[model samples]
Every structure is written in C-alpha cells, then in structure tokens.
Target: MLLSLPNWIIHLSSALEWGIAAALLFHYGKITGRRDIRLFGLAMLPHWSGSFFVLGYHISGDTIPILLDMSELINLFGSTALLLATLNLLKSTKKTSATSYTAALAAIMIAGKPQSYLGADIFDAILQLSSVVYITFLVLLLKVWRRDRTIFSGLTVAGFWFVLIFISVTIFCMYLATVVRGYPTLSHDDLLHGLAESLLSISNLMIAIGAHRKIREYKREQLNAIQG
Candidate 1:
C-alpha cells in the first residue's frame, strides 16, 4: 500500500510548494536584499523539504524516526520564521511597535517548548494571537487600499489571499482543539492536523505568487522611472 498514491501527485505537490518558496525568495532578494526576509525564506525551505522527507518515510517506514525529527526541526524553524516575517513586514510599514509584539510572541513560543509541558498552551495562545493580528493586518490593508488604490494593488491581492488562508487555518485549529478536548475517544485530530497543514501549504504558495507579482511590478516601476 505504500506509495499507493500516484507518483505524479506527490511530485506535483512538492514541486508547487518549493517553486512558490523559490519565487518568494527571489522576490524578497530583489526588494531590499534584507537578511531577515532571506532568512525567513530559508527557514521556510525545511518545511517543504520535510514534506518530501515524510513522503519518503511513508513509503519506506524505516525512516520514520528521522522524518519525525526533521519535522520537529522544521516546525520550530517555521514558528520562528513566521514571527520574523511578520515583524519585518510591519517594520517595512514603519510600525516600530511591531518589533516589541514579535519579541513578546517569540518569548511565549520559546517558553512553551515541549520540554516544559506548556508548549501546547503557548502554541494555542500564539494561534489565538495570530488570528487577531491577521485580522488587524487585513483591516490595515483595506484602509491602505481605500486611501491609495494604486499604490499597493499587488500587495492588496496578496494580503487578501494571506488573510483567507490565515482565517481558514485558525478555524481548523480551533476545531481540532475542541475535538481533542471534547471527544478524546473518537478524536479526528489527525485529520484536522493534515487539513491545517495542507491549508498552510496553500497559503504559502499564494503568498509567494503575490510576492512574485509585486516584485515584477516593482521592477516595471523602476524601469519606467529610469526611462522617464
């Protein structure tokens, strides 16, 4: 039953995820060449890498331990990267307070490490906070669009997709938590987890596409300015 799924399906999904990540990295590099975004993108690479690792583990079964270890590392990296990316984006908008917010969230996540048995609570809190932040961020994007419709058109599209994905993940996470607490016997947490992961992958892909478009637009603007 191993590798029962079509090989093409697996490769196609992997290719799409990595391709999106690469596009985001290229755009981030071109924008400001900032080390933070580059590092963020690098941190994201492992998640996609671990996906393939897990797929291989599924097929072989012998490498389950290695795949689990890799997955843990990837999760940690992604957690940190999400905080860093949000901070960087906020900083780009000249929001100095966002750094402090990011630091607080990072501290909470660090404190909630599994060794302390408080990681779950911390992670849950982080998710809740992220949901609020995402909503606020979307509102800000809407306000920006209203004020200067053309200035951030590409970003607006990107933000829309990002918010959609964020909302979907948040809802699924909430449902999963509820199911775990309320129906421990018939728990469908694993399915929920898979759904969340898939949604996140999709979200990343969408953001990468948005970033690519924004990068192209920025380059066009630069060229026009130069020629004018």
Candidate 2:
C-alpha cells in the first residue's frame, strides 16, 4: 500500500518536531529561572517515544515479546504524563481548578484497563471529557493573555496554537473513529492515524517554540531592568 501525501508529510514533520522540541527545551532553560519547564518538556517526550514504538511495530510485522507485555504500561505512563502537563499548564494560570480535578480523575480512570472492558464508548467519553478540559484551559490562557499580554507572550501564543491544533485533530479523529468507522474503509485508517500523529507533532513543536521565545523575552526584560 502506497502512503498518501498527508501521511508522508506528517511522518517527516514528526521527525523534525522532535529536534525542534529539544532546541526549545534548551532555550526554555536559558530564559526561565525555574527548572519546572523541564517537566513540561518531559511530559511531551512520550508522544514521540510512542511514535517510534508504533513505527517499529509496523516495520517488524512481528510483535516484540517485551513490548507486547509493556504496551499497557507505556500507554498508562504516557497518558498520565500528558494529563499532568495539561494540569500543570492550567495551574500556572491559577484558574480552572475544576478542569484540573477532572483531568486528574480522567487520568486515574485511564490508568487501568477501562478501555479494554468498557469498549470504545467509554474510551470516547474519557477522550471527550479531556478535550473539554483542555479547551477550558485554552480559554483561561487566552483570558490571561488579555490581561498581561507580555507576561508569557511567546509561550502563550505557541501553546494556544498547539492546543488548538491538538484539540481540532483529536476531535476529528475521535468522531471518525466512532461515528464514521465503516464508511472510509481500513486504508483510510492508516492515513488518518498518520495525519493525526503529524498534527500532534506540529503542535508540540509550536509549543516548544513559543515557550522558548517567552523565555528569551523574559530574560531580556530582566536584564534591561537590572541595568536600569
């Protein structure tokens, strides 16, 4: 089966995103006096790691003995990291306490095999709930931006765009996977999955860039203040 343009684009984009993310982390370190941004960067690491795992599975055609056993472990850890990152970001603004609690609950629900026994409906519900939480966080961030536009301007812009892309793609894919499952056929599955992955990769890159830029701006401001 030949890969479509979108799939190819996303694949290449993901590979590049990893590099961009690394650079952004370095820049973030330079700007922020706090080391906590490292946590955010670490949270994003699993997405790329999962990408590699899937890629390896596709290429090998045979499941790795250890990986098969560890798949659930990987998923749980990765999902938890993502959820924590989302919560941490919200916490930064000191808003959305309810959303943070909901996110935490959802993460706990996902820790076990709820999806395996409850089926797609349950999984979809969790995902939808998460989507709402993230959306709310996005709104809160925008409100913050309105108040103090320069506080974390670069990071905020990048984070907003990244979250927007993520939420858009996630909702679309969830709908397709649930409502339109049979219409497009199986071939479309691979293409959609690849496209979704690519979008997430781009989102991560944008966030990293934004965070890096914010850090630089913060440092410049601090330096100027010190001199004055």
TM-scores, all models, native as reference: 0.56, 0.56
Q: lDDT per prediction?
A: 0.53, 0.56
Off by over 4 Å in 2: 4-6, 57-76, 85-117, 120-198
Model 2, residue 140: distance off in Å is 8.0
Residue runs of model 1 more than 4 Å from their true location after superposition = 7-12, 31-36, 61-66, 106-201
Task: Determine the C-alpha RMSD for candidate 1 after optimal superposition of all C-alphas.
Answer: 6.9
Please list the Cα RMSD from the true structure of every candidate, rounded to 1 decimal place: 6.9, 6.2
Record all residue pairs in model 1 with backbone atoms less than 3 Å apart, i.e. clashing: none
lDDT of 2: 0.56
